[model samples]
Target: MEHKNTPIYNAHSYHTKVPPQGIAPCILHYTDPGDLILDPFCGSGMTGVAALMCAHPPAEALHLVHDARLGPRYAILNDLSPAATHIT
Candidate 1:
């Protein structure tokens, strides 16, 4: 997917931060609705944001096949740093 600099991505700063848009596609590809995703080293909690997007995808992301699942997926994000967890 093309990289889009969205507000949520730009809202914070982290050394290993990833855009939620980039991660959403992967989440949508690998998991079904109501599925759980675990990110052990979730920097800036982009994975959680992505999982939320999969559940309530924007109009632009309606084309993703996982939307057929008719439900929202869940995410568990954890980071070694307290700052990262707060950023989520």
Candidate 2:
């Protein structure tokens, strides 16, 4: 069977964090195989996850402003508070 798009779910505990399902497609479409995505106010790092999925490997392929607060680590992520950063 063919797989559909990524499902949207509560991936993180944030008030207004975009889901990876929604952001991934945009990231892949807009950027090439190797590009740098910087989400300065990366709330939940959904963008980072999206970036990672697009490149899919070797960590060095793609880059995201992936702060430790966020799940991925390719770019520098920043948040207003530890809670926000932590959640991302």
Candidate 3:
């Protein structure tokens, strides 16, 4: 699938959510398919969005997927802020 400069992950409000464009390259460079990407302070889950774009650019939303060789790639989105977690 082709990757867009930014995915459709900013449909909600977030005070400090990292821009999808900003973090996507880092995710692509450091991670692989079926890997678990963790964001302890994931304000609004841009990291998961980035990771998902890295592994599967066409995905419409965050979800677990089965890979034939690597099993499943997961996005562990977490935050101490209830608002942030809920937003994520």
Which candidate number maximizes lDDT?
1
lDDT of 3 by residue, 1-88 (tens): 2323344544776766556645655555556667888789988787877665665443323223333222234689888989888876
Query: Which predicted model would earn the best TM-score?
Result: 1
CA shift at 39, candidate 1, in angstroms?
0.6
lDDT of 3: 0.61
Per-residue alpha-carbon lDDT of candidate 1 for residues 46-87, written as tens digits (9 for 90 to 100): 888889888666644556554445457899988898888888
* Rank by TM-score (best first): 1, 3, 2
| Cα-based lDDT for every prediction | 0.77, 0.56, 0.61
Cα error, residue 23 of model 2, in Å, equals 0.4
Indicate the residue-level lDDT of 29 in model 1.
72
Per-residue lDDT of model 2, residues 1-88, tens digit only: 1122334335446666665645655665465555678888887776777666664422322243232122232455677778878865
The TM-scores of all predictions, comma-separated, are 0.79, 0.60, 0.65
| Candidate 3 wrong stretches, greater than 4 Å | 1-9, 56-73
Q: Between 2 and 3, whose TM-score is larger?
A: 3
